[model samples]
Target: MNRAVRIGVQIQPQHADYKQIRQAVADAEETGVDIIFNWDHFFPLSGDADGKHFECWTMLGAWAEATSRVEIGALVSCNSYRNPDLLADMARTVDHISGGRLILGIGGGWFQRDYDEYGYEFGTPGTRLADLAQALPRIRARWEKLNPQPLRDIPILIGGGGEKKTLRLVAEHANIWHSFSDAATLARKSAILADHCADVGTDPAHIERSTGVRALQGSSPDDVVGDVLDAGATMFTIGVSGPSYDLGPVREWVAWRDEYNARQG
Candidate 1:
């Protein structure tokens, strides 16, 4: 299927007060983003090391209530933080609260600080990926047995670029696959993902390709967005930080999405 181009914004839930974050979310929805995402991290990924930060799922619950239009989720939730069944239940609850707008974007844990401060074992990358491999099935099964069940199917978005394991998992399970790849890298990895999908008897087109694009310093969206589209990504995401939470670039990308979707149509 030829999916329509979509725009998403990751409102970094750090370095600002909740009020500021809430305003950003409102602004993003009002400005016409299709999806709103926040990262699942205990600390700031940028700026000061000891900056103000908030927990992921709780804020998602709030976003579920705060906005009525855009789909909300973590850019990628860490599989190591909570048990798979519990996480599935949490996602189901959020999906209900949002009236069916939750996207369960998850990944194998990566940040060491999160694990260290939270008392989770800082396991090796191989072990972490293995754990994620084990968790996906349990999460799906839990979703099936939940009392009320998710409001919808709860789109599963897996974020990572590991060609061997992560991409394979995405091929096997994800409704959406997200990565931070340039056009060339996206093309290569996408081909690899297609091969993985073929091996697993999945139609590669069944998974939406999503990637993060930086709002270039003083450049038009046309400069980079077209290249990414050519690389086969239908979902484009931009990361906007808090405090100011500039939406100028977001607006531009939204316009670009409209134009692109029109052309596709």
Candidate 2:
């Protein structure tokens, strides 16, 4: 059977207080979102560049206990930020805490600001992608040796649309592929992914298609939902930022989610 569509909201990790962030997670789960995500960044990605921000994995660890039912993960954790082996253990711990509700969303490091301030090498994109390529295997190997493996296999979500190297790595390693491209770009890239999968003798269908749908002005909740799913995006993730964490948009999307699921039935 074809996999059913689901909605996700990336409570943007910028300009929000913990109280509001926590509330957003609770509300999203209550509203029946399938997943909740936060980005990995040192500073705000939106709003004021120097505005309030929070760390990714720590927030996810908290989200694990604060909400039940909805899966939680980083939109894509930067590989350069932590030791890959350590990252595996961290993910395993969160996976157990969340009762196997963690999706290990990760990617080649971007965001030079994060690297510059944190003392990580702000290498060229090529160098960073190389590091990511090397880390994937190390992370997997450590997971095997770690005392208690992840509560489940803990799905690996790789986000990037790079054709030559990144998607090749996705074909080999990721359980989910997330990219920011529009529908046409997604269709094109997915075909490239299929070819990569074929080259590796792997079944492409095993990797889920995940895409980001940045909320647009004046767009109604129903319109966003309809357009994204119709675009062949099964997993839709909307981003929200704040001092308010105004889940006004999330609430609307959640209502639409209920309707979408009912229609599927």
Candidate 3:
């Protein structure tokens, strides 16, 4: 497959009514974003920590009904929150509802607040990765056993940069790998991921590379786009939030995406 760069917008789900969120999704698709995402957390990860927030899969279920075309999923769902089989079932249901536009973005999880409040274990990182390693196959197996089955083979997006274990799990399971580091760091990790793929006999090209870009950090979308493309990332996401869901940065990204594609062509 050609490694054409794409843009994603994570409508940060904080301090906004569902009505505003719904409109934001519509605006994003209209602006030509390739993917739309929301973080999976019970509470705000940023401003006003106790601000109004929504559940992940449930909001995705709603997104299935609200949006007609754009791919939608969690930025990185906490794998420890729900059982693997149950999560697979939820992904399947959303896939069917969206006519196969769902991506199962998940991770071993790091937020202690969610684990503590939800009664899940706030175990060591290695233990959480171990659980994730076990959960991946079970999720895939359940997808095969489900009655209606998924509308399609759902893509799995794993987020983390752990070289030894996390990247190894990604090599074994992920269809997409999301990381939260700079371009140089991502380049190094991509090489590490390639080594893991070699060890496991899986082609490194089978996994899409995704990374989050912060627009206000004095980096233009085009600048980030160039760095990410050079670093082997195909999917670049910008996270935005508001009581209004300001789309200024998203529009800039969409414009950059068009230019990038045109240049490639």
Q: Give the per-residue lDDT of model 2 (tens digit) for 1-265.
A: 3567778998887887889888888877887889999999999976689998899999999999998799999999999999999999999999999999999999988898988899999888789899999999999999999988887888999999999999999999998999887767877888899999999987888888888875667797666545445545678788877766666666676677677677888
Ranking by TM-score: 1, 3, 2
lDDT score, residue 180, model 2? Answer: 82
Candidate whose lDDT is highest:
1
Error of 1 at 61 (Å): 0.3
- TM for every model, in the order presented, reads 0.98, 0.94, 0.96
Would you give me the overall lDDT of model 3? 0.89
Q: Model 3 RMSD to the real structure? A: 1.3
Reference-based TM-score, model 1: 0.98
Q: Rank order by lDDT, top first? A: 1, 3, 2
Which segments of model 3 are wrong by more than 4 Å?
Answer: 217-219
Better of 2 and 3 by TM-score: 3
